[model samples]
Target: MDVPALLDWFDETARDLPWRAAGTTGWGVLVSEVMLQQTPVARVAPIWQEWMARWPKPSDLAAATQGEVLRAWGKLGYPRRALRLHAAASAIADDHGDVVPADVDTLLGLPGVGAYTARAVAAFAYGQRCPVVDTNVRRVVARAVHGAGDAGPPSTTKDMADVAALLPEDAAAAAKASAALMELGAVVCVARGPRCADCPVFDGCAWQRNGRPAYAGPAKAVQKFAGTDRQVRGLLLDVLRDTDEPATKARLDRVWSDAGQRDRCLDSLLVDGLVEQTPDGRFALPGEHGAVSPRG
Candidate 1:
């Protein structure tokens, strides 16, 4: 695949996200990577801007309490990510002098950072020429390069190698190519309703040459949130997060009517440390007041 040409396409068409602006810190890139996971870019932008304005560095974020973290997370969904981000910030402050680590292995050791994120931070944050593959990138690669309509389940090693092979020898060019791959997937080579007419690689694309066959490997399940445990859990958490003091069990019960389901969701939240149980049986978010300063 003519990666340099696609990078040229990106230079013209790339979305002007704040994190993509010149001089954005590694911490900004890290936060954007985390928030953009399974969440839309439009939804994450304002929140990311506000978050960066408030907590510009890992040390600033590490000083916030768990309760504060979750409350600030708002309706992003999957609130555990807030906890994970908090924990990662704590690690960065404590272990790395509050500077976000540039190496992929070091990033992998941080809480909740996986292979994709580590590589993303290395490539995007540090210009380290690492491959950064997301679901979008996988689909783009599968269809364009391999002639498959869509990727099956992700294989980290294979995805990394495939994307890495397309990178330029130059580090800065490689980072731009990584972003190009992702940007191509995001705006042009979308999963549903891809704008093939606008795709820059149409001439050489394997899928285009092969007549764009339908994905027949395995049916992907469409995610539904209504009337599910996840919905119930979100509701239960909302009740606790809205209040400062612990709420009575009876108060929490009002959000969802099904006795067993509500109890199950609440129990999960309590178990996951998103919700805390008082000795008096009231529920609240964890209430620690102070944070330990990182070593100089």
Candidate 2:
């Protein structure tokens, strides 16, 4: 593999992400990882910047109320990630000496820190050599190494092994290469359409050499948001986020017409610790039953 060529391409084309900048703290990297899960970087950037500016460290976030955390998360899609991140911040401040742990295993112990995220933080944040395989990295490896048109069903063990084997001997170089692989997949080698001409490792790409055959596997399911419980949940949360007063049943009902589905979604949020019932039986963001949170 032309490792230097790949790294050079990355150096030239990589997005100037704040987390990737020099001197970004481990906590900053951790926040970015959690926010970026199943969410696009473009939507995550402003929220991440404001978040880092407000809660510069785990301790800073830990000191914040659950309502404050939820309010700050604001439409990042998966609101549960905000709750998990808050839990992680609490753990870091209380147990880990307010330092984001550098070890992969230790990082995995934190809330919302999965294998890919742990490896990413270890490699990108701490400059350790580790295989950081996400959907993008997995797709890049499938085409570039195995000649497959698409990655197989999520296989962490096999995917990690494939990525680790391709790592350079030098730790820093391996980290750069890992980032490059994900970047290539994200931009040039996109799933639906690959710009092979711009790919840095086009010469060694197995799928390209094999004539870019169509994937014959079963079609992946397309997620629908419109009329789903998630939409109802979002609507309910939106009502709460917009006002200091707890949302009465009639007010919350305005978002969705179906009473059963709306109630189910609200119940789920309450159970998830994202929303709570006020003494007067109105709904509000957790820990913000009557008071408005300061938004920065």
Candidate 3:
């Protein structure tokens, strides 16, 4: 790979994301990584800015109630991630001296910090030369290195090794290269209608050299949002999130028509510790149902 060429392209074309700002801390990078999971960057930016301002450090977030964290998370979808992030904040504050750990292993120990997230924080936040393999990075590697039209099923061991090999020896340069590869996949070597004309490594791209064959790998599952249990859960959570007071079962019923599904979703929410039943049998976000007063 033409590492210098790719880095130059990234230097000129990388998105000016707030998380990439010089002043962003490890906590800021961690929050951005979590928020960016399966969520668009545009939607994450404003929310990330709000979160950074409201909870600049893990301790600040640790001090907040889970209910407050969920409310701040808004409609990011996967409300469970919000809960996990809150848990991580508590761990970081209490166990890690209120600091987002720099090492991948220590980062993985944090709640909800997976392989991709751990490496991302290590490379992007700490400028360590760790492999940060996300979907985009995988795609870029599959095409550029392996000559595959698209990345097949994820193999953590192989994927990490592939990216690790591509990284420059210098830690800072490797970090920049990781970011550059991700940006290239996101913007130029995109899954659909790739703008190969703008690709920095076009001449040397294995997939391009092979005439850009179509992806013939295993079919990927298409996720549906409408009418799924996830949608129902989001609807139920929406009702609780919009209100400061507890919602009656009857009030929650209005969101979904199927009594069984609604009840099941509600039960799941309660089991997940996302919602709590008040002494009066009303549903409220965690920390809002007990002795704690609702935030203004």
- Maximum-lDDT candidate: 3
Backbone clashes per model, in order? 0, 0, 0
Sort order, lDDT high to low: 3, 2, 1
Give the range of the ten consecutive residues with the poorest summed lDDT in model 1: 287-296
Q: After best superposition, candidate 3 residue 9: deviation in angstroms?
A: 0.8
Q: In model 1, state the lDDT of residue 128.
A: 85
lDDT of model 2 at residue 286?
82
**lDDT (Cα atoms) of all candidates against the true structure:** 0.88, 0.88, 0.92
Predicted candidate 1 versus true structure: per-residue lDDT over 1-296, tens digit per residue: 87878988998989999999989999999998898888999999999999899999999999988898898888888899889999999999999999999988899999889988889999998998888889888999999999988898888889988998888999999999989989999998998899999988888899988889988677878899999999999999898779877788999999999999998888788677788777666778875422222112
Which residue segments of model 2 deviate by more than 4 Å?
Answer: 290-296
TM-scores of the candidates are 0.94, 0.95, 0.97
Candidate 3 residue 280 C-alpha distance from true site, Å: 0.3
What C-alpha lDDT, on a 0 to 100 scale, does residue 207 get in candidate 2?
89
**Candidate 2 lDDT, tens digit per residue, 1-296?**
56789999999989998788888999999999999999999999999999999999999998888888988998898888998999999999999999999999999999899998999899989888999999999889888898888987878889989999999989999988888988998999898879999999999989888888777556778999999998888888988888877778888989988989988888788778778888787778887555333222
What lDDT tens digits, residue by residue, belong to model 3 across residues 1-296?
A: 88899999999989999999998999999999999998989999999999999999999999999999999999987888999999999999999999999989999998889999999999999999999999999999999988889999999999999999988999999999999989998899889988988899988899978888889899999988898889999999999999999999999999999999998888888888888888787889998668333222
